[model samples]
Target: MFLTKIDTLGNVVFSRLLGSATNAEAFSLAVDSQDNVIIAGSTTDNLGDNTRISGTDSFVTKFSARGDRIFTYQLDTVAQDKPAAIAIDADDNIILTGFSDGAINAATPSNGGRDVMLLKIDGDSGQRIDEALIGSATTERGEAVAIAEDGNILLASIDNGRAVLRKVDVNDFSNILFEQDLGQINNSGAISGLRVSGSNIFLAGSTSNSGFTGTAASIAKDFAGDTDGFVLKLTDNGSSADADFVSFVGTEAFDKINDIAVGASSVFVVGSTRGALEAGGREGPTDAFITRIDMATGAIEQVQQFGLLLTNNEATGIAFTNTGPSVLDALGLPAGTVDRIETRSVDSQTTAKAGDYFDISIDGGRKRRITLNEGDTFSDIARRINRLSFRGDVSADGSNGKLVIRANGSASVDLIAGEGSSDLLGKLGLKSQRLLGTDALFNLNDDDDQNSSSTESDLGGVFAFKLDGPLGLQDRQTAAFTLTQIQEAINTSQRAFRSLSPSILDTLGDQLGGSASGVVPTRLQSQLANYSAALSRLQSGSGGGGFFI
Candidate 1:
């Protein structure tokens, strides 16, 4: 294990590495009144005079304020043992809560698989004072621990799949004062944060249950997605606990709380989400969020999400500093890097054909038909729209290969396609929409307009005017003039010819060519050759000739 002490300016004062021959890992740490750092973890190494019984063993190490080694205490066991949280009691006594598969001391025995373990040690002597193992017939994990105002120990644990809270008498290890199960029996949840203020106890975690209404008088919020982060406040009476409020916060995706901190007037929580949690949507597949809630009423005050859209980000820990609540997240971007979303067209179509016309009405004005001549590009479309004297500025963004229409000054930009318009709007990769004069810019591209109907109509018109036989069928004319479309048409035609009877083939050959054996007739061969040449031209970006369709 590595430990370091730093000055106020973040300069390292002293550093030390404490471990045995094998691997050692530290999970929880706490500081005493004298600034003595105490760490709790599990290790396979046999440090000091203690010997490892079997598997992994739990250990607590203390260091002085100046980074000198004070003492190390190890709890030997035959099964794996690990501490998840550490706390300092009123008299500077060390308390550790975690999970173990076997007995850590003589007083408590293993319940079954993995059981929650609570250990109390003398801060100065590094001696075990008491220990307790709490679990069911199945698995249980001790996740978080806090001290109440009345000098009692509050433990948050996962009993089976349910989150449970227990108030234990600090003097007597086996005396449990009160216990409560957090959610419904069928719902699976876990608690990662616990805080005590006055007579109220706050618990934060996540649950998969929907419509989680606490007590009838308690303030509650319904679940919003697959998994939602929750904050439950309980008024801890002398004998029992009553629910104050239970609030769920999340979007339409997975969200979970990692930690929480209570200030004088507000409760702050930090977590991660896959969807939007505030007015602005999420920035990436996953984003870290911090939410502030009213302490007296349990009303959400504000929520903010931060991260880049290109990568994942999450907040694992948070605490209240002198200024405000500080969060530790996993975004590793460089300094001064700002994250923003870019709007791009889903379909890249910059070219338009002749006879394509669409009626557009801007800012609720009179509808005007915009017609395209032969071989008009997106830039020409923008220029033509500008000449119509609209309240919006239209530009062709060549870098992103899309058209942008922004409202001029404070005037809103309304783009409406009239019922009598042609397929020109679809060809330009745009749709009828409105921008309400907001500062938020909107793109003039339609994500649903992938294959332009006008292009298909042109190809079909060409085929109907030039070809006869099966190639001249109206269905064949509807095919788009793209390589993939032409390839599919060719395959369908070949299949139809192969499935024809001998007599039908002979009739076709007599009208067009001669033989109808294994070889294709002259007329059919000529049509196939035309399609082959069209495919080559489309692949090379050269327009097809007379037989393009």
Candidate 2:
């Protein structure tokens, strides 16, 4: 894979060129599941022999896991333009997006100046389906394209001073959905760069007006700056869906934005500017600025500025990977440095290395744990973490951070401190945890503490924790007890059930039905009784920490 390492001294340590840089050929990049690099742009010449096409053509290169070029494929069309952007889909389909000059009579008269072209090629065979003339030909130039979950191709371009966003059928390349303008731009608007998250579209361009505009809807026709840099949010269909002032503007005059990329929670835009915050938030000077904006609210974040003194350093393409921090750590770069990757494997897994003293799986196969604290209302965890699996109880130490993990092949699960709150839950879906108990629990699974991940949707989660693993779930309406409390419950229940002939409800009258109908009835009565008896014996004399053993 072609790797570019930028050190703290602003020196690009290693810009290794992979495969053959065919003369006149440009390579667009993406990462595969195994972190392999895949480059798909256009190749004009073979082995620097000669330009293969009248205009820039299509080229794809495959790289080994260790940055070695494995294969190269060149594709071409009679079009006069060149490939612009390339991205990989969920199925590893390499999407080549660019503009074409020659008219594809098969499509239309072509978008006046340039027609948006999309080519989907099999990553392995280089087999491709050409999608030429995607949008209006009125100076329409495709800047980006992405493959959606439904196998539809989302294309973004600029035409007639408007950002045209649309989804085309993957098979026929027909417009499945589309919209017109993204930002409330002046009549002189033109989309230059584009990015995507799922089906959401992010576009950057410039707009100018000679007439008056309205401020009621925040749409200002006559912007403050001359061709200010603006970042816009678009939907699957390119429409003016954001607030009029939603697009952040730059300060410098004649600022034409180049590329846009999205990070963890930040939206990055790079272009010309003299450190001004127009409708598009603030920007660095003409020194090729990279500004981060909040993904949810579109608010600009004031962070470190790179290349503030460079004369002509222009930020072109952008990509991000999870190991960016680790790369920084290895390179001794400052924290918060971002790394852009090309293509990855089909089943690429993200994981953290296991540290000593705690059980946090470094690989993607590890399980998840939900910690608890004192005064943690059972409903608190249930409401916060979706699919809350409360199998264990609070810690013996006063720290309430206990956990209920799935059985890990054993009959017990333990909770300790020092586990990071955020990173530990990185792989977890937002609000995917739920509460399984009001306190400590167990005995519904294989009768063990070795909690492992149970992916079965129904058989997994806290809701699956039944009192007997066959009957109803255990009742936990009190404080979250610890492992000791749970072990005691197991002992008490087993003894009672074993002696009472496996409970017909009549046998568990005191535990299941209790003596009467009340809050302390049924399950609570049994638990309270067992708890009292266990406490008396444990706190007797030499029961250190209430006999943890």
Name the lDDT value of residue 278 in candidate 1: 85
Whole-model lDDT, candidate 2? 0.50
RMSD (Å) per prediction: 27.1, 28.7
**After best superposition, candidate 1 residue 389: deviation in angstroms?**
99
Kindly report which residue stretches of model 1 are placed more than 4 angstroms away from their true locations once superposed: 6-8, 18-20, 185-188, 211-216, 323-549
Best by TM-score: 1
lDDT of prediction 1: 0.70
Q: After superposition, how far is residue 129 of candidate 2 from its true place, in Å?
A: 2.9
Score every model by TM-score. Answer: 0.56, 0.48
